[model samples]
Target: MNPELKLVAARQGGVFSRAQAMAVGYTPEQIRERLTGGRWERIRHGQYAERADLSALDAWEQHIVRHRRAVHAAMNSMRPGSAVVSHHSALVLQGIPVWQVDLAEVQLTRTSGRGEVKAGVRHHQGRLSPADTTRVDGLTTTTIARAVVESAARTSFEAAVVSADAALRRPEVSAEDFRRLLAVTECWPGSPAIRSVLAFAVPLAESAGESRLRVLMRNEGLPPPVLQAAFNDAAGFVGRVDFYFPDHNTVVEFDGLKKYADGSREALIREKLREDRLRALGLEVVRVTWADLLQPARTATHIRQAFDRARRTRLAG
Candidate 1:
């Protein structure tokens, strides 16, 4: 809490190099005491993060706090231009969402093959143009578009779709941006995985759950559904459903965590009425939740049944 140390921490995103602590008039014993008392947490060899700084963050934010500290620590220890953060670490710096990626290692990239700067470091050797790299969080990182594709290439198809969907939904990253970045990486190794994800990624997927649902449908060979489809009655706009099949008059809704985690009674009542309106319009509605997504086969069966029912109703009418 010293004035100089506070200023130093502010300059470094609530992290301070050990030398900064010393130069700011803190003795070695003082630093040891702070660490012993949990006032400061060591973020790798030469960096420290204040306990107070991370107290308000959730689990993921806390991990990011540490991740950034690791980035800076490595940057400070290495020779200039030795490595630039990329892949998952770069995605984190660019504020892009990554699905099912290991966060334990600090990710860095060098155009020339080189050994790591520290322990727990993941090093990638790839050609990076200025268009593909940008500075974020005071460190060199891959641009959002590049990071999304690169990280996606290193993950499973489902995870890749989730990350790509998130990138597509970002206001700063347009469909064109994705295309440009994909074009830049077309000749790179392991790009086919990401190319496949980009081919199917939809911006209408507003959450990880919705992205997962879309991937789930695709993997099962189900007919693609129209996203954010609206249902209206004689009164007015009734509701905008998540996914709709015009071919079968079926509506598929993805019930995300927010639908239940923080859902109020008013929201629940409105949701029920919305469903009623859709059903009244003779559309077969199938709601897919996280649980249903986990049981992909079961969810597919439910959707298939809904499509069949809608077809039968259409024939009868």
Candidate 2:
């Protein structure tokens, strides 16, 4: 790998923007020819990554590179307000799965000018400061902490918390850094998201899906569920539930497509058998998918209804 490619790999597989290319000694024509010859891939406008190992360009890697390049290009061409990447761009840089998107947009602070800056790119105006910002791949971005807050702000309360917890659990980010980042957001617009994230994003950092469901439940004012609660029976360890409420005997399972994309029938069958065994243990299990995450209100309602039914069964027994 060349020095540039090495740098990109260090950045978790980033792509180069046109401005980045110019800074690194590649002209627009050279970039174009690289794309034409399949030497480089155009992930988004003015963004290019090497096709040296196309297989390595998984969806997450490709999306992060494209977003990074887009943010860099936008910042280079921006006026009035300096663009500091936020939301999905920040999550991508932090290697979190908050918003899965291919396009990248430069999120500007409130001081940005009113006119439209670019096509196919989004500009988010918010309160920001120098302390909560960093430079990556030649683009300004909200620090990992700020990005976690922004990601949570865009999500239901619990989802945000889970993402924040995950961000903090990463060795690159520390609890102290998260607090410092939160302190700076005191004057930031949408501080509710920041505060809520700070309060709930903790405590369940080890459980991926629990906090997301908890946030949704909290948004609906439902009682918080237990995390990693296990059930035992004569048939050995039944299974582990992502979120469980002992009183209601209800469970929530978060599923990511990557888990099953391997296409193993035996694995799939084993998973199903586990679910069946859990159901047989008199647990009312609810499956939460990515789509349900997008519709949190309905998901919360569904879970609440399941709890009601489980309560009735428990009372009868």
Candidate 3:
């Protein structure tokens, strides 16, 4: 590629438009020849990226890069601030984690007048205050709090909590921010559901998988356990556990099942020692994994049984 074309691609995130190619001294005919010869690939109408194997990148990464290009493709022709990225699109821009979100279209919100409905963009009438919008990477987007609520209002409860918990981890967003988001979206279609998740949301959840397990356990009728409960014995503090049932002397460990695969030998040994300490205290440990989470009822049943066993074991001892 020529110097100018390379510069243009670099500025445009490895993707450029036909107009960019032309400005870089390539004629329309030359662009067509490049496309025909497989030297470039069309990501969207008028949006092209150099033809290179993307097998080195994972599918999710490739998806994000293409989404960014498509978003740029949509924004390249849009008026500044007139089309602000919102909803799930804003979540992505804010670096928030997402699961079970629709990534098929780049969503935009009108900052002023009704935004034009473009072919590849989903436009919403989001008359947001300056406080509710943020600029990320030269792109306008709804604030992280607003984006989290907007997305939560449209997704399943578990998925929304995952997002909400993740958003709460950020210093910019807070519980009050969540309340404000809920208040503003009060009349929205999914407001009640979103509010419920917000009410249940906690910042202490360290992972989406943990948030999800909490939701599952609640929905299945298990008594809500205190989160990150600290344990102590005569020696010293045992450790903080994911969930603790003080009433029944039980501890529920939420494992994503990924930890078992990655934690080194020393980490595994330390974890086992921690469990042994908890068990020595006569606290029955109930482990919940991804598979257990899928069958919430069964998991709840096992937990109840553990609760009973712990109570009986403590009495016997």
Candidate 4:
């Protein structure tokens, strides 16, 4: 590839259009040769990227990366400013964590025309005011608040809450912003569910696991737990917990890999010590892992058992 095409591909998330290759002095045969030789990978019709640019990534990360490249490719294929990236695609572009949302199609919103899906892109027909859209990484996309609401309207409640919680953590996003967007999209399909998501979303959720656990607890009819609750003992601040059931005197921690990324003995020992301190403070510690979340009923049972034990211990005292 020439310097010109290299620059173009770099600007578009390592993707380039067929026309761009030609413009940069590559013949169609040359492009075909590169594709056949496994040097260039086709992102979509008329869009290609160097295979080397698509590095090995974990399943989730790779999905996001492929979706991002597809988004850029779709944008490149369309006329400039014809559509803005919206919905889950916008959330991905803004680096917001989304759970269980479809990334198979790049989502775009246009000011007019009926919505349609074609060539791995979904175009949504909606009114996007200036306030509802912004530029993320040089691509026009719906604002975080707008994106969250749009996504919530189309996905499961659990998925919506996860994205909404992450979006709320952004300084530029607020509950008011979501409410305003909600008012605009009030009559749309699934608006009520979006409303519920906004009401449930909190900026305090520090990770997707914590957010999902909160949703599961609600769905299972468990009492709402205080998020990121701090516990102190005679030694000082014991630690901040993921979820705390004040009435039950129990602490629920979402044990995701992020907390134990190092997987070191010392890290495990420190966590054990932290749980011991919480126990010393008369709090029942219940740990929830990603696997536990997959079985909501079992997880809820475990938490309830902890609650019962804490209550019994208190009564015994």
* Model 3, position 90: C-alpha lDDT score: 86
TM-score of 4: 0.97
- Candidate 1's C-alpha lDDT? 0.81
Cα RMSD, each candidate? 2.3, 5.2, 2.7, 1.2
Expressed as tens digits, the lDDT of each residue in 202-282 for candidate 1 is 888888888999999988889988999877899899988889989989999888657555758888888888899899999
> How high is the lDDT of residue 220 in model 4?
97
List model 3 lDDT by residue over 236-263, tens digit each: 9999999888898999998766666675
Candidate 4 minimal-lDDT segment of 10 residues: 50-59
Candidate 4: C-alpha lDDT: 0.90
lDDT against the true structure, each candidate: 0.81, 0.68, 0.82, 0.90
In candidate 2, which residue ranges exceed 4 Å CA deviation? 1-62, 72-87, 100-102, 108-142, 150-159, 203-212, 294-298
Error of 1 at 177 (Å): 3.0
Tens digits of per-residue lDDT, candidate 2, 201-244, equal: 65443555555556667777877777767777788887667788
| Number of backbone collisions per candidate | 0, 1, 0, 0
- Model 1 regions more than 4 Å off: 52-65, 111-118
Enumerate residue pairs that collide in model 4. Answer: none
Question: Where is the poorest 10-residue window by lDDT in model 2?
Answer: 99-108
- Cα error, candidate 3, residue 156 (Å): 1.2
Q: Estimated TM-score per prediction?
A: 0.91, 0.68, 0.87, 0.97
Please report the candidate that would top TM-score against the real structure: 4
CA deviation > 4 Å runs, candidate 4: 53-56
